[model samples]
Target: MTWLLLAGAIVSEVTATLCLRTASRPGAHKGWRVLVGAGYAAAFAFLSLALDAGMPLGVAYGIWAACGVALTAVASRVLFGEPLTRVMALGIGLIAAGVLLIELGAAH
Candidate 1:
């Protein structure tokens, strides 16, 4: 199903992003370096497949970015004790709204 492909896209994107974080830290192990490279490659490969399946680029991109931002923010706050200010919440809300708008636009 298309939804499954989209889910794959989300997973790969998140993996890639998390990998980048792991890779960026100084002195990461070789395993982490391999993971990061594989993650990035898989992310692009999955996303490209999603695009090839007739999804609009804008819609796919919007969904991917929105999901990434929302999930990553919550995860970082929980895992890293990162701050979550009202301004950040507002920004995320706006991002959600924009994603909704993109979805609605696609239906017309």
Candidate 2:
């Protein structure tokens, strides 16, 4: 249950970030701003639920941040034609590895 909530938080956060990018674009519709705000609110709420369910703060946040960043970058490239440079991909890979280390450390 805690993991599920954390996953929800990650998805919400990534969606909010993408909506923010859309909202920042020239001639973007005002509705995107509303979506951005609501998505962030939902993300926080889900994160809080995960924390309440006894997930360690460091582990939860690490996973949420890493996955959110990686997913958002890929989504941006696919949806907005943004560039995914090799350097950026490498950074994302590092983030994933760090998160994995955090999770493994938390197990012991």
Candidate 3:
């Protein structure tokens, strides 16, 4: 349950970030702002729920941030034609590895 909540938080945060980018474009629909705000709100709500469910703060936050970043970058590349270079992919890999290390350390 805690993991599910954290996953929700990550997805919400990534969606909000993408919405923010869309809202920033010229002639973009104003309604995208509403979605951006709502997504962020939902993300925080889910994160709080995960915390309340006994997930450690450090582990939860690390995974949430890492996954959000990775997913957002890939989504941006696909949806917005954003440049996702090899170096950026390597960075994403490093972020995932770091999060994995954090989770492993938390287990000990």
Candidate 4:
């Protein structure tokens, strides 16, 4: 249940970030802003629920931020033709590794 809440937080955060990108574009529909706001709100709500469900803050936030970054990068590349260069991929990988270390460290 905690993992599911964390997953919701991650997905909401990523979607919000993507919507933010779209909202920044010239002549973009204003509705995107609404989605951006809602997504972020949902993300926080889910994150709080996860914490309430007994996930440690360090572990939950680490995983949420890492997954959000990775998924946002990939989704932006696919949806907007943005560059996902090798360096960026490596950076994401490093972030994932760092998050893994954080989770492991929190377990002990």
**Best candidate per TM-score, number?**
3
**Of the candidates numbered 2 and 3, which has the greater TM-score value?**
3
Q: What stretches of model 4 exceed 4 Å from their correct place?
A: none
Candidate 1's C-alpha runs over 4 A off are none
lDDT of 3 at 79: 96
C-alpha positional error of residue 93 in candidate 1 after TM-score superposition, expressed in Å: 1.4
Q: Per model, state how many residue pairs clash.
A: 0, 0, 0, 0
Tens-place lDDT per residue, model 4, 13-96, is: 999999999999999999999999999999999999999999999899889988898999999899999999999999998998
Task: Tell me how far the alpha carbon of residue 51 in candidate 1 is from the true structure, in angstroms, after superposition.
Answer: 1.5
Model 4 whole-model lDDT (C-alpha atoms) = 0.94
Candidate 1 local lDDT, 1-108, one digit each (tens): 555677687777777677667677789776877887787677677777888888888888889879888777776677668888899889889988998999899999
lDDT of 3 by residue, 1-108 (tens): 999999999999999999999899999999999999999999999999999999999999999999999999999999999999999999999998999899899999
Q: In model 3, state the lDDT of residue 103.
A: 89
State TM-scores per candidate.
0.86, 0.94, 0.97, 0.94
- Compared with the true structure, model 1 gives a TM-score of 0.86
Q: How many steric overlaps does candidate 3 have?
A: 0
Worst window of 10 by summed lDDT in candidate 2: 60-69
Better of 1 and 4 by TM-score: 4
